[model samples]
Target chain A: AQSVTQLDSQVPVFEEAPVELRCNYSSSVSVYLFWYVQYPNQGLQLLLKYLSGSTLVKGINGFEAEFNKSQTSFHLRKPSVHISDTAEYFCAVSEWHSGAGSYQLTFGKGTKLSVIP
Target chain B: DAGVTQSPTHLIKTRGQQVTLRCSPKSGHDTVSWYQQALGQGPQFIFQYYEEEERQRGNFPDRFSGHQFPNYSSELNVNALLLGDSALYLCASSLRYYEQYFGPGTRLTVT
Candidate 1:
């Protein structure tokens, strides 16, 4: 089974400051990586994804993540965050299932990014 | 497109009762997956529906069941609800082996 681990449960940062949310996963085979953000009482929105490409992946809302195969990490980063960025962020991993012909996402506990003004 | 959509934004039910949640996949999507998100936790996969049949499922109990329509819409039915079942039910839609788009979840409260 594949599982994701988020190091920080909550991160507090001032507006315009840079932020990083660490994520690591354990899987026996290659997997696709994704980042999602959820506002209060709202559905999750995709931030970005790493299917097969360069290690660096950019997402919506000026966010980005680097996929490190050696470390089994896909850390999300934002150079400058706004107060509106305050939300719960989740890191998910998915791998193709040949029998099902679909990809199932396994998510992390989530990181609360609180950007203070 | 309009993205994935769920019906009955909120629902409250008593213990041992049953509840049904509905979802319509995003335009051009043919697969629907259901997830449960508890307070302060991430979403847990419940099951996946493809071609009107259950394709994948997680470690949930048999009391949890679902159905998929030919139009690619889906429904999640929870029988004999428990307080543990109180959570946000999220529905996601996608093409096979592709990224999924989420819908605003249905908040289910079991008393």
Candidate 2:
């Protein structure tokens, strides 16, 4: 089974500061990586994804992530963040080799990103 | 286009009762997946449906069931519910092997 581990439970950063949220995964077969952001009481929104052909994936809200196979990581980064970026970020993984009937996802707990003004 | 949507935005039920949540997939989407999101936790995969048939499921018990219609919409049914079943039930839609778009979710409160 696949699983994700998000290192930080909370991240506090001032506005205009750079931020990196760490994520690592465990999977026996190939997998697709994704990052999602969730506001309070709302469902998730896809920030970015790494399906293939790109280790560096760019996402909305000026966020990006690097898919590192050697380290089994897909850490999310932002050059500069705004207070509007405050939300809970999630790292998720899905099997790339699975058949048509299944494409289950395993998700990390989450990282609460608190962008301070 | 309008994103995925789930109906009955908020519902409250008691233990042993049954509840159903509805979802309408995004335009051009044929697959719908359901997830359970507890407070302070990431969404947990519940199941996926395509072509009006169940395609994938997670480790949840049989108490959690679902259905897909010919229109590509879906519904999640929870029977004999427990307090542990209380959570925000999210619905997402996707095309083949593509990234999914999510709905606002239906908050289920089991007391």
TM-score: which candidate is best? 1
Residue range B44-94, candidate 1, lDDT tens digits: 999999999999898899999999998999999999999999999999999
Residue A40 alpha-carbon offset, candidate 1, angstroms: 0.1
Q: What lDDT, from 0 to 1, does candidate 1 have?
A: 0.96
DockQ numbers for every candidate? Answer: 0.83, 0.76
Candidate that would win on lDDT = 1
Candidate 2 local Cα displacement, residue A4, angstroms: 0.4
Clashes of 2: 0
Model 1 chain A lowest lDDT segment of ten: A95-104
Give stretches of model 2 more than 4 Å off: A97-100
Q: Which residue pairs does candidate 2 place in steric collision?
A: none
**Candidate 2 residues A79-111, lDDT tens each?**
999999999999999885365546777889999
lDDT of 2 by residue, B33-65 (tens): 999999888889998998898888888999999
TM-score of each: 0.98, 0.97
Clashing pairs in 1: none
